[model samples]
Target: MAHSRLQNINNLTTIDAKGAGIYIHIPFCKQACHYCDFHFSTSLKKKDEMIAAIITEIGMRKNELEGQVIQTIYFGGGTPSVLSNQEIQHIITAVYNNFTVIDNPEITLEANPDDLSNKRIAALSNTPINRLSIGIQSFFEEDLKLMNRAHNAKEAEDCIAAAVKHFDNISIDLIYGIPNMSNQRWLQNVAKALQFGVPHISSYALTVEPKTALYTFVKKGIITAPSDEAAQEQFLLLVDELEANGFIHYELSNFGKQGYFSQNNTAYWLGKKYLGIGPSAHSYNGTTRSWNVANNMLYLKSIQEGKLPSEQETLTLSDRYNEYIMTGLRTIWGVAVARVQQDFGQLYYDYLIAQLQPFLDNGLLSFKDGIITTTRKGKFLSDGIASDLFFLR
Candidate 1:
């Protein structure tokens, strides 16, 4: 039985999806949020040039994943909605021209609530983009102000309603753990999202990253740091409410109705090959991971010179196993014990089992058959727990 399970896991190594996915990063935002530390520029002075450069980069890296179909295309970063409908279409056209894409690829755009006006939603529906991921951090005015979000309470509600009319495959982002956020407020936020009939929700607990305005505020006593207790309580509430409403906790931070999972993210977590285009974007092809230069000017100049402004590192065996463990523990898939043994060798499998004993003993992890997964108590702490299990080189 053990031999067969290990064999099946070993076979997963060669099982590639029909095609690779593409990620296009648009790293421009109109307003800088207080808590965000992602690489983005607030100025749109070079927007047009950036767009052209991204398209050019697409062509330059066309052969990176040759012989594979482009299954998913994701527009992420500062604010994908900042681009005009025509600008977006131009890039999509470039993609079609440069790559072999399927008839109906899953194309998603991460839009802000303020950008999803009725007209804009209608125009987007006409495009090939089949999914929308709205950044609706909160539906309350106080929380929005605290986060320095550009959109207000009404826009949050109105946009989702407007988006639902045109797009069925919609996902909205919500943030929890804001200082002074009561449990009741959190419940209301979740309820409002449910009222929208959105098929998917990607919610996260707000954290204070260094050098961000939020961190400075906390240091100056302007804002209270996020409470772990509150975050855990809110996360539990989210799981209970969403699961009751027929949403699967597909990934740690993602919930989707049946057949509504984000194909782009799923492909990423499954270790499928993907190409990322734009400043600060990252790409992976099963072994090597690469990231573009985070500076806008440098990226454009590099692309114009017909060179990629990116750095890549090939994965070692330990790196692959650790990545698999980290991502696997955060999703419903869990870590496949047999796969660890087959791919990383018996030493790794034995090491993993030994490392897992404490978590299993503490009821934070569970092992059944040949799989090891986080228990309900361990869900919120999955990342930390996975780290403790990492195999250091």
Candidate 2:
């Protein structure tokens, strides 16, 4: 049955007009990484219950995206790969039963290296999941130990070797800017990922989010905080190396070969509607945004009682315009002047143009053909620039 799904894998690489996506957050993991703060439990005791709640949430909110087609179904969070093939299939079947999914939707599974053993990867190849986003944070053992990742350095390399034989639409993640990592080591990390011949790579700086184990380490001086200067240098190095090797720096932290950009994430960046199921998952329509509660037990209890455990807010005009600016400037697609004028008003258009002038003059932003985009020199600072351009309420 899954072999038939492989026939259309090539067709699932690109994004289309099918605007809706479904993001299922699997909140169970084998263990928590030290540098992480996303919601997930270290125990698998409630795994079955959580899966039931996720499927129920899918049916209960079917009407939220009533007429839209689901172009992508993404399994993200603690470690989606921790679920068995049967469990994963059950949730997917539920989505198909409730939603109008595209004929060849891009179904992505976020797997950690340790969870993707040779047998596991082969079994997954037979499922509807066509894309694998492996979390190979670092190629060095020391870095892996520092981050407290479940997989060691060897498991990281071996998983990619095994995965490539079963999956072609693959993406591996790498983190740079660890406290003591040199630029040379970061380059080697990028080179190791390239050796696998995967189509997509999502690299991010190791940020010290408050309340994570890494934060505590930094606070107690057991580990030094990652330096901003070092991070920026590594970020620029990544951009040059990947772009030179034929990957487009399509988004701030994502690079992909042509026709291989992340369909699920691109949909979000383009302002498409998506339903986020499971604990701590966020959903967005054009006018409003909502998210499920982060507590796994509470989520299951609420769903069992036939109620939605989520909160939502309607977006104001300023909220919409500011979001467009933030997401637009992060991608190759620049913010359109006409869109601001048409979507907001002449007042917004004038304000945006006036605000962007400083960045335009300083070689940080470029304005061409009425679209505003960050220059090569400005890509690393895009977030800060986007904030300055925001229409403060």
TM-score of 2: 0.96
Query: Model 1, 186-240: lDDT tens per residue?
Result: 9999999999899899999999999999999999999999999999999999999
Which candidate ranks first by TM-score, i.e. highest?
2
Error of 2 at 323 (Å): 0.7
The alpha-carbon deviation from the true structure for residue 351 of candidate 2, after best TM-score superposition, in angstroms, is 0.4
**What are the candidates' C-alpha RMSDs?**
5.7, 2.4
* Worst 10-residue lDDT window, candidate 2: 1-10
lDDT of 2: 0.90
lDDT of each: 0.90, 0.90
Task: Count clashing residue pairs per candidate.
Answer: 0, 0
Stretches off by above 4 angstroms in model 1 are 1-16
